[model samples]
Target: QENRITTVQCLSGTGSLRVGGEFLARHYHQRTIYLPQPTWGNHPKVFGLAGLSVKTYRYYAPATRGLDFQGLLEDLGSAPLGSVVLLHACAH
Candidate 1:
C-alpha cells in the first residue's frame, strides 16, 4: 500500500500553527478559523497574521474544571461548511 497523506514539515506549536495558517489562507475557500476558547494564547495572533479571521468556540468550563462538551458541540455545529478548526494535538 502506498501512503496517501502529504505532510509539510515545520517546528512544533506556534511555528506549526503559523505554517498551517498560512497554507489555509492561501488555499482554503473559507478564511474563517475557529479555535476553542481558552486555547493557547498564541493562536489568535498566529492565524490572524496568516490572513484568516479568528473565531472562538466554547471549550473549558471552570465549574466542572473540564471540557464543556455541549457548548463545544453547539459552537461547532453552527460553523459554516469548510471553516478551518484549530484543535489541540491529542497529547497536548
Candidate 2:
C-alpha cells in the first residue's frame, strides 16, 4: 500500500518553510528543529521566526563537495526524538 501526501500552496520556498514552521510551532510539542548544514540561506530565519530552536546537522562535505553521510548520521542519531528536521532535498 502507498500513502498520499498533502501539500500547501505558497509563494516560494521561503514562504513554504515559514508557513510549515509556524504550523509546527503552533501545534507540535517539540520546539527544537534540526536543519541540514549549508542549507538554504533563508532556512534559519524562517524557522526562527516560528519560535523554534534551530540547529544544524551535518550535510555538506566540504572535502568532497557532496553529502557527508557519516557526519549526518551522527548528528541525526544524537537528536532528540520528535525534533523537527528541515531537509534540503533539492535546489528546486
lDDT of each: 0.89, 0.87
Clashes of each: 0, 0
The runs of at least 3 residues in candidate 2 whose Cα sits more than 4 Å from the true structure, single-residue gaps closed, are 1-7
lDDT of 2: 0.87
Per-residue lDDT tens digits for candidate 1, residues 4-49, read: 9888888887999899999999998999999988887889999999
Off by over 4 Å in 1: 1-4, 90-92
- Give the RMSD in angstroms, all C-alphas superposed, for model 1: 2.7
| Candidate 2 TM-score over all chains jointly | 0.87
Q: TM-score of the candidate numbered 1?
A: 0.88
Clashes of 2: 0
Q: Provide the lDDT at 54 for model 1.
A: 96
Q: Write the per-residue lDDT of candidate 2 for residues 18-62, one digit (tens) a residue.
A: 899999999999998999888878888889999988999999888
